[model samples]
Target: MYTVNQLGKMYNLSRSTLLYYDKIGLLKPSARSEANYRLYSKNDLKRMEKIATYREAGLSLESIADILNSDDTNSTTILEQRLHSLNSEISELRKQQQLVVELLGKDSLVRTAKIMNKEQWVNILRSSGMDEDDMHRWHREFERDLPEVHQDFLESLGCSPEEVSSIRKWSQ
Candidate 1:
């Protein structure tokens, strides 16, 4: 048996997180010491490992709970959904990587990635057949992924406050 702190350390989780899991009925200690400290058994550790795996796969707490509660958990559908989501994300990242590579090839060793100003980025998007909606999605993804960098990039483009506000609002 292990204390709650020791169990959390084994899983690289915080004490409060374990307490929250216990409170939510997602995980419970095998026993308690005379002082009322939580004690985890090997079975609890195995369950915690499964919980961590599901969480890392992006399953919601409620979904994880349902799966744990169900005797015949139909996980194939959920796994397929997650796989599809991951594939789409991979495809998007690949497109971004290709765009970066193409941009880099536009100049010699002296010019850096910073040279692609706002107008150039917009032009590139347009030339790549990115319509208004596609451009908006791209900007929204950019802002969502890196808000500070997006702001700095817009500023580097020398866009006015009104322009920046308009662009951000439209992209959103």
Candidate 2:
């Protein structure tokens, strides 16, 4: 059996955190010492390990408790919901970032906060089944149909001014 302090140290958790787990009925000590201190058996260690894993996956304490207590829990549903929620948050954050860059009126700031580069753009196109010839044709069409937007798009990919100029010249 391990004392509360020993278990906390083993799991890199604070004493209060373990106590909170106990309070929430998520993990109870399997035994008590002679002096009434908490004593965790190996089974408790395994339960704590599962709790740690679920926490790492961004589960709330209540959700963790439900999952631990229910023998028929649908963990995949919970995980998928979390994934969708995270995607929405990321999209909102990207919009906020764009607004900040625009508000500052600093194109250089956009470069500093660059989310993608020319290499990444090229890789994405390649992954989407675009060959070199297909990419050139697409760029030519973009330059012909929406020159200004095309320029901004290239700049957004973190291209230098000189590189953007060369690409536009070739796209013609």
Candidate 3:
């Protein structure tokens, strides 16, 4: 049997986190000492390891508890559902990554256009019918407010606000 501290060190988890797991009845130790210290066996360690694995795979504690406690639920069905969810998440992230790559390419084009002579720039803008004053106003407004607006846009896109804002500014 291992003490709580020993178990925590072995698993690289904090004592409080283990205690919280115990309090929630997620992984109750198999035994206790006369001095009231928690004692865990090999079986307990195996259970904790399984819990950690499920958590890393994005299963919530509540869901994990249900899976562990449910007698009628088939483990194979639960695993298949989790696999489907992970695959869907991966697909969505790949789509977002493709959008980022396209945006970066557009930013490169914009930068190349900016480096052109004034007349060339003006002609390009004229061909596009993009007004100079409007462009300037837009640039200034984006400079001042884009961090927040981009944050909102990214949140809508299911990306981290900070990460999306950084990517948006990277194009500028």
Candidate 4:
């Protein structure tokens, strides 16, 4: 048997984290000591090991609990869903990296990448006879109609997260 602190130390998790897991019904102590302190058994340790592995795979505590309380088929489906999300995030990061490389004037591999900087985008808008008010109206319409697409367009233009946030806020 292991005390809560000992188990936490062995798993590299905080005592509060373990307690929270218990509170959330994700993990419960297998036994209690004479002092009424939480005591985990070998089976508990095995469960904790599975929790750690699932967490390392980026599964949420809720998802980990669901996976643990279910069969192998359910766990596989959850893992596959997480994999899809991770792949999409990786693709977005790659686009952002390419934009950053283009911004830095690194004329090696990313020079031919079709990325439009802020200045070029603004210039194109101005050339198209879109004054400041016209652009604002356009943004408003875009935000009202397709907020997610607007966000993606802003990100593709290499806007900083802060800039994108500000634009979204005002567009609302």
Global lDDT of each candidate: 0.78, 0.84, 0.71, 0.88
Ranking by TM-score: 2, 4, 3, 1
Q: Which segments of model 4 are wrong by more than 4 Å?
A: 107-172
Off-target runs (Cα >4 Å) in candidate 3 are 106-172
Q: What TM-score, computed on C-alpha atoms, does each candidate reach?
A: 0.56, 0.65, 0.57, 0.62
Candidate that beats the other on lDDT, 1 or 4, i.e. the better one: 4
Mark the 10 consecutive residues where model 4 has the least summed lDDT: 102-111
lDDT of 3 at 86: 79
| RMSD, candidate 2, Å | 9.4
Q: What clash count goes with each model?
A: 0, 0, 0, 0
Off by over 4 Å in 1: 71-73, 106-172
lDDT of 2 by residue, 13-78 (tens): 999999999898999999998899999999999999999998997889988887787755466667
Q: For model 3, what is the alpha-carbon lDDT of residue 94? A: 53
Q: After superposition, how far is residue 89 of candidate 2 from its true place, in Å?
A: 1.3
Candidates in descending lDDT order: 4, 2, 1, 3
Clashing pairs in 4: none
